[model samples]
Target: MRRLGTFLLGVMLLAGPAFAAPLAVLVEERARSDYADSLPPEGAFEITVKEPPKGEVLTLAEFWMDPRSGKFLANAVLETGDVQRIGGLALITLPVPVPTRRLLPDEIIMEDDLTVMRLPVGRVGAYVETEIEEVIGKQVRRVLTPGRPIQAQSIIHPLVISRGDRVEISFSDGLLALRSPGRALSDAHEGQEVRIVNLISNKTVTGIATGAGTVEIVQ
Candidate 1:
């Protein structure tokens, strides 16, 4: 048994680069450089080392990538002055915007109400928001949990004019200005088109909501 154990130890020592921490780091750096344009400012890549290169590990001299296959190729210079070809598979991670705290329905989202988190690209849903700017100042449509990615449909622009509210519809062409009383037929955010029913004419018209209770007729 002692001799068998000794033989196993010898074989293990003969195996090069038992731990591939350096190789993992080098692969991550290559991913960062290759995916720089697609990554957000605070975004980063997470590399999972599935297969570590086998050789007398020394230093990674060169690195390149095959983005389509999510594979990385590299050259490791061994102590024997020989270059060893190495390859690895990695999973890329992406950044997404999330709420910083539990947000109640209809609550307005402020800049401080949100945070950013990284998730495996496969874990991010198609409708999840990835940019913070897309969420800030928006109204929460449903409850949001802390550190969880917010779905695109869960947040919306704050409504400036609500349905059934009295609004003033204004039309102006520099030389002429006119205002008409109307009732909002639909809810709308500032600068969004809203359906309004003219109080005097008893007809519905679409206009852009310019402010609180104010709709502008573009033409």
Candidate 2:
């Protein structure tokens, strides 16, 4: 009896979590004005869900949980119509189709059999909300949510260049040139910061000449 009780306790501990279902949620359809006076046709608008598991449903509350948190943090009202008949079982999936007209700023639109509900959006399991707000009308607004955050280490532009600076080019041989606004100079003055553009390879190189007509190509 003692061994049986210990075995039963262990099975209960392991099975408890398996019986708890994850909170169901869906991402509401989002819509934005294109800055035109006339509204685009209803069918012309669409919202794309980003990040997370690609096929996971987008729901108001689920969108708020920071994925890094590793906790399912949101919930939603599921519609019977959105439920699918799979092998005689109802299965819920990501991106249950809702109409485009229901999305608002910080809100997600969901559909039922009779009407659509626009509810405040929330984060999903372990995910944090990173939505941006934009004004659409005198009193209307919209939210722009990015799929992922931009990393600080990603290079977007050249870091070492500045405007109105000299660029130099050196040839494999002892030839040099200076490139400036609207002109190129082959005979550059010594110790002058010069700019050079390679005509063959179409690359720009820069350096200060050590002497007059003595520019040597750096291998």
Candidate 3:
């Protein structure tokens, strides 16, 4: 590993005439990369080149320095392809949505439960939540730690109506509207069909659960 870094540095120093003067450089590479699909081999060399070829982007470049010296300086690379000397503590972080408080399993999610904050990008997953609407009203599928990134699979559409619950059955056609007290024969969520028992007529009917404690007759 050391030999490869040294070889890269030697090649980079020879990139242009500006770095021809004998000098030593220290460098570090980001091991993680951002991508939605297939990610290419993780690499993009950023070396201290006094003057890289103007208007031309360098690809497959390398940087290295002699290891004989006991002293080495710390440095960081910026998004604009600039090698900067790190003189003090630089907290590298990435923006991501995280839970404001610890969330227990099966807890209904609310907009106030989450907040966007900066975290180490490497520790965040590709499917981390990015918007408030994504998690709002969702049911927590697993326990979530406070201030930790919320993943897509951590929440789900909650079952609005559970089994054996009383519900208002609504039937409508044209200008006619009728409502009857009914009991849910099976658990269901919004927009899902459930078997309902009309309490007044004592007859079973299938309807779509439309809201809290409510269902619409299919017919």
Candidate 3, superposed: residue stretches over 4 Å from native = 1-95, 117-130, 151-153
TM-score of 1: 0.67
**lDDT, residue 161, candidate 3:** 78
lDDT of 3 by residue, 81-137 (tens): 444332221123456667889999889988788887765445556887766677888
lDDT accuracy of residue 84 in candidate 2:
17
Clashes of 2: 31
**What is each predicted model's overall lDDT from 0 to 1?**
0.77, 0.29, 0.61
lDDT of 1 by residue, 11-69 (tens): 54598543434666666776778776765555455665545545444455677887655
Local error of candidate 2 at 32, Å?
Answer: 26
Off by over 4 Å in 2: 1-155, 173-219
Off by over 4 Å in 1: 1-21, 29-43, 48-56, 59-89
The residue pairs in collision within model 3 are 8-63, 9-63, 9-64
